[model samples]
Target: MTRNFNYWSQKGVKGPSPSPMFGNILSYFITPRPHLNMQWQKLYGKIYGVYNGNKPVLMVAEPELIKQICVKDFHIFSDRNTNRRIHPILSKHLVVETGDDWKRIRSIVTPTFSSSKMKKMYPMIRQCLDDFIVELDVYAKDKGDVNVKIMYGNYTMDVISRCAFATKTNSHKDPNDPFIINAQKVFAPKVSRALCFMLLPTFVLKAFNMRGIAEESANEFFFNITRHVMKTRSNSQKKYNDFIELLMNAQKSSTNNNTKDVNHYDENDSSEAHHVNEGEEEKQVENKILSSVDKYITEEEILAQSWVFFVAGYETTATTLTFASYELALNQDSQQRLYEEEEKQAENKILSSVDKYITEEEILAQSWVFFVAGYETTATTLTFASYELALNQDSQQRLYEEVMTAVDSKGEIDYDILARLPYLDAVISETLRLHSPAIILIRQASEDYKLGDTGITLKKGQQLEIPIYAVHHNEEFYEKPNDFIPNRFLPENRHNIKPYSYIPFGAGPRNCIGMRFALMEAKLALAQVIKRYRFFRSPNTDVPLLLNKSTILHSPKRINYPFGAGPRNCIGMRFGLMEAKLALAQVIRRYRFFQTPNTDVPLQLNVSLAIRTPKRVIIGIEKRL
Candidate 1:
């Protein structure tokens, strides 16, 4: 039966009219609101409506309403609203699952990303960074400017590939590894899925059985690499303290328990009479054994979780680091400050260490640049921050003073020290506000729930999304919303901001888990870069950055500043920032960055599978001393 209702429209709360055939179809593809989605909210108000011919989906902007739907009444919206047909290609991993399966998977995987585990992976991260620095030194040997974006991407890809997956992607040397190639294919925006198919019901898509690009080869490649590593480790009985080792140990424990359970059941005979004590004893043994075994993870489950980590980590971080270099090239002042901080940090480390010198792990932990999370988002933020700084010198100077004074007094930079610099924090925050990389935080509704005032129920098994861009740019929340202003995020002014008004990482139970990492990276990278270079408007840079609306992450049409935002945001955010800061500091300490007539200030940005510059940022680097 066809269902129709006036719903919220009856109460004068206006929204986009629901269209059965082409419900916001054109807008979904052509204009993805690269910067912000406030225009829609202004036109439609808090409660908006959309229909993909069959399903009625509402876009709610009110924070309280979103909280209620996502948290308070989660049961009704428990199931994910995606096309289950794609499960084969896009495995039902933790990111897409719901209910008991999600609960179980999350429980098993949560420990993998704990603080202790990340600390253990620090050495691996530094190894990748060292390799990256060597590569950079080679490129900069001729004193020729390098494409920072590509360099950073290669660095990040190598780091995550080795650290997360326990495999070598060598994206630095071979850009076309099957693993990388397949990942790009899988994540690439499918025109049908983004437009027509995204709205189609899961049942409808499954009935037709639409197959995505065959991932058999990619899966085989990854699986074999994992299997071989596992076998070798088992054979040697050697243990390396890494994520892969943990997974292997977990798998072994699970297998042993399973074997014991089978043997116990087999031993029990139905016809044999047993005493009450014997039965109780058996039950106690079973309970104890199962309890111990249940804590271990399975091989299949590990592969799925680990592979997702690899795929998600590599692509996002690479894109972010690339964008960050683009920003450093443009914003010389910010770059210079960052470089100065690095020098001071290096000097302080050398002076403080008596006999036992600072190891790579110590460097990684202390260097905030390497710990920040959102690489792409932060890089983009830097790009935009540079643009705004160049455009508004007063704000730039204010930020410089804040960073320099703090570093000068402390002798070395610390996370808490950096946090106290209100202006710098505000500038970073403001940049994020203006150019958030992720536009939509996609999640399947856990269950059915009613939206505010709109009595219509959002049924289970429906895909739900929070329009991050829209929330950040809402004029109702931010004054002169489109214009860049650092003061808006200043201490006194920040109180006016709404609860969910700025969710680059999202909110509620499933917010981006790596927010701290991203922030640390950004702070460190920016600190080092700004210490040496002085950014000025270049002819290559477009006065007003033209955003590429095609890709999932918001990217510039030219090489802009780099940095991304959010929680489950970017794990290597800190690492990317430190790398950027180190590179800038090293170069700027020796040279002055100036825009030649040929320099691309508003350079064209290439928005492909990853964020890139249209061409290498051309600038004249002159020796300072």
Candidate 2:
């Protein structure tokens, strides 16, 4: 029953001691997973080992080693351990696939999230934001304190649904919406806790026929939605610029795929019927059908992709907005600086035109990826920034002044202008250091690799969990690691931040795909908010945040930090951030945020829920004059 997976020490990798029965499981379970990883990094060494269940896990924090593992030698560590095989469809998405399959899909989808493509999606988000602002005003009128998590979550869901699925239902106003209901049902932690993936190898779990993922009927319904959408698109002559259109286009193109050979190969080239021996060519076509990537996207595949988008994009931003608003409510001095300022506009040169679309399976996925990762990650960081600012007014005011001095009106934020607010950038960075929502940069070793000159070698199948939380909080890298100090990220102080130690978005080749998007969004939103409303510490503001025990993935995503890392990092990071910035900017422009008696101070994370989250963010808002 007890085992110590001290493979690191056996291989001469110096690090922390592991317990026999649970290895580091208990440690990770009690504290946040990232914090746990950091603890071992500090107590043992930046390079060490701990057991993940029964498996040996390398807890790497050293920048140089991190650089190598995440970048230079990514080939050997390309696969991730988190695979969902129970679901027939969900498992097919790029997030769950490994090796060449992952590569093929990633390529098909990457272009959809490009700058031009995202510009097309922006209007959808803006439309959702407009509704969100109106909703906020309604809440501000009669509410004691509002639950921002719910508010923003619905807003993001509405936005992603329209842009990614090309289907719309008012998730905020309509609780009975089938899409929202079914979306919540998928990947429910209740099903997972009963039959955990970590308890055994993925294959073994698959062998046993465990239903850790959503049930079959649920997936069937989900599939039907996408199927209907695709059928409608194909039969109709209507044209839309959203993700569905792109996917349908890609799907239609792939229907005629004919692999290139020597001198000639065209997707529509069925001339083999005219030239080649029919029987032999037919047999060869059969092999290719089974071997190569699916020439055409399946309805199930498209639905699965759609589901992933809904799941990933919905909950994240709502939580982030909640935290951002809550923090602003708690820090009045910072809020005051904003009350004295205004907004600004930007030029249209920043926008672009899309040249191509992506595979339907990929189209749905990338659209969701752009929406969710961009929406939630940045929102969460803004939440932490607000929290930190409320508690640390000095930093908050400095940021508010920057926003005030940078922009002149309530219009689009120029990219160049957003870049000018260094203090706003610092606040975002510091907030990421203290909070990062997604935890760790996970990479799996593909082959035996040496750990620098440390004489330690990691064998293939072994996992590396670079604790973003620990690295960000390491005292060696950050003085008073626990404090909220934006100056730590200032231009003069940024160099002191050691290369990998400050990887909120990770480092090297496999860093977050949406890093640029997230930063831009956060900067714009914070600037806009500071230009208008003042954030003050409310009675409900949590002084020292507490994480819940039964968190779905790992510790509470309540704080912020880590958008993941490596070749498999979050793909739609840019979209999420853009939505966040746009929404936050709009929010602050309309009203001032404050705390109320119903707010939960020293906020308690939800113990019963699968995801680690604040129980509630009940913040008050007043209309700005």
Candidate number of the best lDDT: 2
Model 2 gets an lDDT of 0.52
**After aligning candidate 1 to the native by TM-score, how far in Å is the CA of 552 from where it should be?**
3.3
Root-mean-square deviation per candidate: 12.5, 9.7
lDDT of 2 at 375: 38
Tens digits of per-residue lDDT, candidate 2, 327-426, equal: 5565554444432222222321232221122344544444333443443344445555444444444444444544544444444454444443445455
Stretches of candidate 1 off by over 4 Å are 1-13, 17-20, 71-79, 131-149, 169-172, 189-216, 235-242, 249-296, 318-430, 443-448, 453-463, 483-496, 516-536, 560-625
Top of the candidates by TM-score: 2
Residue 106 lDDT in candidate 1: 40
Expressed as tens digits, the lDDT of each residue in 356-390 for candidate 1 is 11111111111111111223344444344444444
